[model samples]
Target: MAIKSFQGARKQQSDTSEDAPFKVSDIMCKDLITFKPEQSVEEVIETLINKKISGGPVVNDNNELIGIISEGDCLKQISESRYYNMPMENDNVEKRMVKDVETIDGNMNVFDAANKFLESKRRRFPIVVNGKLVGQISQKDILKAAISLKGHTWDK
Candidate 1:
């Protein structure tokens, strides 16, 4: 189906060229490679390096999101371990993960999500459905959604 702004139930007249509101599911990345709390920090870093990702959501065995792990979180520990000449293999992700993660609803409008990005310093948000991790929405995803919406204009 076409993503036209002024069409069907969303055909309300508006001044701006943009009008239709899109949801997070329209642009969120579904195929996410998640990590567990018990997993090693070294392994997570290796995966992030290999996959070319900056971070990933930390989840439990039941697939419930617990925290978020990023390269910034690992930097201090990695440096300290390297200085002490300790084994990085045993350091778990939980030790450095940010536990108070802010998640977003998958049904939220992409515009609202964009505002979140603009107002906050976070690079990405974990999209949740019924309290379970479903997907991820990045700044790039928001930009992509905006570009897709640009092709659609108000009928008025």
Candidate 2:
């Protein structure tokens, strides 16, 4: 049998006719950590620290996304509250969570996802499907993807 040439092999590998366009679902992390609306800020903070996540979507009992909480939101608590003898019960995620949330469909393209992130004030966004929370996409995730794709043929 004749051996295939290196150039022929390279050409075959480069052919992407069957390749699908990149979508948010393809890159988004599906194993999402979510917080409940009734959960205290302290509990949420513990989850964040344990997971090493900047933030996550807050969902109601029905698993519908209600808001998003981030490290920024946590910091807001300290900055806004007075240092007087305040009760731990005074701290709650709902009080500090950004209720006005912006979200994207999982099927969105990476370009559109990145655009939405840039246009919005929120650094993290919840990925939804049919109004249900599925995953989270953050600035860090976008930056990671950008760096991973650097100097690659896909950059063209």
Candidate 3:
């Protein structure tokens, strides 16, 4: 008797299948709470608290992402003010926000984006297109995408 292979037929990756890679744009948050560089740190803090967000992107009137301001940046201001015994005045997002901002492409795969988050230790990434701010992707968004993609083959 001839010995036969026991493995079942494997599923081939298909571009048109539901298992197709999900892009960052598919899950990114389009409605973002952005701030103006000239906005006060106090105002940014207030919006962060009210919106229950850790941080937000600072944009120009043209909606181009210029920087990112976070709770940690605000806390730094607080600590410095206390150290100098000075009031938190004459402070704005531009004065404290991180000007060197890293952005993610909208067409990038979600898994790749997750790897980026892991490597960079970033809580969120701004999605920019043609030098214009479009959306944002967060750790939570990646988690949600993973959960949704469960039971599907993540070949990539």
Candidate 4:
């Protein structure tokens, strides 16, 4: 009976640890959508609507992320123009996007990433390695991680 009990405890501990190895990479969205700096805002708006995404990373022809554009940015333009019916021709994404975008490394811990997200008002953040965009970590991802880690204790 003691041996059987020991085996059961071991199984429980293993299961707990398996589910609790929370990492930013584990929760980050790998299937990332991206835009190009040269793309028109109208085109990007269409893509955002069709994809049902808030925003996406902006990459160059060499697939290097230069900036990001969000729904908020689009909305700001509309508000500034007093709801003008003209297409987004004169305005470019590069002009509106946050030039010095903050990024997180993929290998960073989920806790640190979550802290950064909370500290900033930006809805989304790009994940990069060696200055190359690999994926994106959003507020949603951090919330999911936090929920997963709730009421859980880890061994040192």
Best by TM-score: 3
Candidate numbers, best TM-score first, in rank order: 3, 1, 4, 2
In lDDT terms, which candidate is top?
3
* Global lDDT scores for all candidate models: 0.85, 0.75, 0.91, 0.78
RMSD of each: 8.0, 5.8, 2.4, 5.0
Clashing pairs for model 3 are none
Error of 4 at 74 (Å): 1.0
Q: What is the lDDT of residue 115 in candidate 2?
A: 86
The segments of candidate 3 whose C-alpha lies over 4 angstroms from its true place after superposition are: 1-3, 8-21
Prediction-by-prediction clash tally: 0, 0, 0, 0
Model 1 lDDT tens row, 7-121? 5575654554345447888779989989999999988989999999999999999889999999998887799899999888868999989999988788888888889988888
In model 1, the runs with Cα more than 4 Å from the true position are 1-21, 154-156
Candidate 4 accuracy as lDDT: 0.78
Per-residue lDDT over 67-153 for candidate 2, one digit per residue giving the tens place of the 0 to 100 score? 988888887776666555565557888887888888877777777788888787667777877778888777677777666665444
Q: Is candidate 1 or candidate 3 better by lDDT?
A: 3
Clashes in model 1: which pairs?
Answer: none
